[model samples]
Target: MTKELLTGNTAVALGARLSGVEYVPAYPITPQTEIIERLSRWANEGAMDARVVTMESEHSMLTAAGAASVAGVRTFTATSSQGLLYGFEMLYNIAGWRAPLVLANVSRGVASPITLEPDHNDVLSARDSGFLQIHAETCQEALDSVIMAYRIAEDDKVRLPAMVNLDGFYLSYTREPVDVPEQERVAEFLPPYRPQSGYMSAKNPMSVAVVVLDGRAYSYFKYQMHLASTNALAVHEKVAGEFEKAFGRKYPAVEGYMLEDADYAIVITNSLTTTARAAVQEMRKEGKKAGLVRIRLVRPFPRQQVADMLAGKKGVAVFDQNISVGSGGILYPEILSALYHRSDRPKKVVSFIGGLGGKRVGHTEFRHMVAVTEGCVRDDSQLASVLLFTDSDWQAVKGMLRTAGKGEVSQ
Candidate 1:
């Protein structure tokens, strides 16, 4: 193993290469382009033995990837924001086929008002799309997750596609020290792709992903998919254990920091969890009894682990980087549902939305979240979701409105 400073994109490319991937179907998009670019370069230089194909669109790219994986080849692909949405339709088709491919999604804010920054909306949008999700907070985790994703996806009990997500620009552009494992060791950990089912070959010709015309057949197949996805919970644990023995680092589904004896807990995900960890340390110095929980594995929700972590806290704050349009933050209600039936649930739980469009969420935002959570605990009252905006933020927007000749807008 060699430790070197590498960007998250490079790390992901290396991980894919180390997994002995045979095929990569790609289309260029901001942030995500670097990952495919690195892979293409390695393939061109003959450093990696793989077929790298540049497709016309994200849709075509995913279709090609699915076809390769179903043909008993180890396949990989990547995309971001609009690109992810563009190929959204094929996500279900691939999962239903039990293709067992890996997709690296560099999370970016979706377009409407348009921005090229990081956010969870694009990834969270696929929560119910039959793909298991593993989010990363650092360059090293980004690399490790990609490698582990392939193992989890290809397991016989959970033959489903997996999405490894990292925040765009944050981890994508930022450089960090990553321990790159030797190929010999990685090979010892991950074997080549020899699928046990849904493989199309001359020796074994089989028809797969067929349409079920009847409602009963459709329901049965759909429920089977859900069960397969649920089986990932155990599969992930097994892979994570093996990965740790092979690489000396293990990632849990729901990871807690200083949460054992805390009265207040902060729940977060993705790259922002790094900042929250530091904030938790500062809060600890001030004797605030604060703690943090970072949700690494997002699909199959990990509700049991989450509920177990926040069980007896005085108050809890769930921070979501994505909003659910007419509703509030996408993760808040889900977190609440996880804790609702617990015998020793938190005294109060609140939701805070921030970090949209790659907005910076730092110590100030962390303090505000803790304060709101404290208030909830003190008053024993339910509160609506709060958007993490400051006075300066509003003033800057006002300046833009004024420049556009709109006057006397409500604060």
Candidate 2:
């Protein structure tokens, strides 16, 4: 077992190499550029026996990747927020064709007013785009999930594209100790590329990715994508078990910390879970039974597992870095959906939106979220979604409410 400090981008490159990918077509984008850069260097140095294609834009990148995958090569690529949207059509094409390629998306906040920061909007925007999504909390998972993605995507039962996501500045730029498994061991785990249908051979001359389906046929094809994504929930657990047996570490789709006897918990994803962990520890130190649940896989969602872990808790504070426009937060409703039918559901779930556009989320802010959760539990009449701001405007609004209530009562 060899351990080295590697940034999340390098870890992904290493994982792709280990997965025996034979082709990479990508364009340079901030936060995600380093992933392609390292892969290109590895291919050039013959460390990886893969062909690296530099594309003019994200659209061309996916186009080439899809074509290469159809040509019977294990293909890989990386992109960011706007790049993902730019290549959005090709994402559906890749999945519709049942091409089993693995793509890494370094999660960046989407733009109107542009800023490079970690947010789920970039990835969430592709939720229904027929790709299996895996969100990584640490550098290790970022690497490990890439290997698992290939296995899940290429499985004969579930041949579909997969996206392994890491936060932009948080995991992408941050360096951490990662255990890179030996090449021979990885080879045993991930075999060479064997395309489902041998492409470009004299034995088969057929049109690849041609649109010739009727409306009902198209709906059936799309339903197949849903089946593949749903299959990932079990496949993830199976692969994680195998990975732990090989690497001495176990990764759950969604991991819960200190919730065995806790009264309340916080549910979050990616690097923010680290901040939540610290806050949970401090809250526990003060005799509050606070805990955390970190979501490692977002696409398959692990809905049953999440519901089982969080059921019967006093309350849950959901922190999301992405907003759903009219909805409070993307994850807030998902959590509620999971717990809605439970007999012992959490009394209240307070949704707190923060860290949009890559703003830093400190432990103090996480602690404040916990305090808000505590207040919600104490007083059941509070609003479901609370937008935390740096100023006291909310307090002023509360005072005005009190004044109006008193006047109405006197009348």
Per-model TM-score versus the true fold: 0.97, 0.92
Tell me the lDDT of candidate 1: 0.92
- Model 2: per-residue lDDT, tens digit, 160-267? 889999999899999999999998988877777778855654467777656755688777777877888888888888888988888877888889999999988889
| lDDT digits (tens) for residues 276-350 of candidate 1 | 999999999999999999999999799999999999999999999999988999989889999899989999899
TM-score of 1: 0.97
Best by lDDT: 1
What TM value does model 2 have?
A: 0.92
For candidate 1, the per-residue lDDT at 285 reads 98
Off by over 4 Å in 2: 198-203, 208-214, 382-384, 392-411
lDDT of each: 0.92, 0.86
In angstroms, the error of model 1 at 364 is 1.1
Q: After superposition, how far is residue 22 of candidate 2 from its true place, in Å?
A: 0.6
Per-model tally of clashing residue pairs: 0, 0
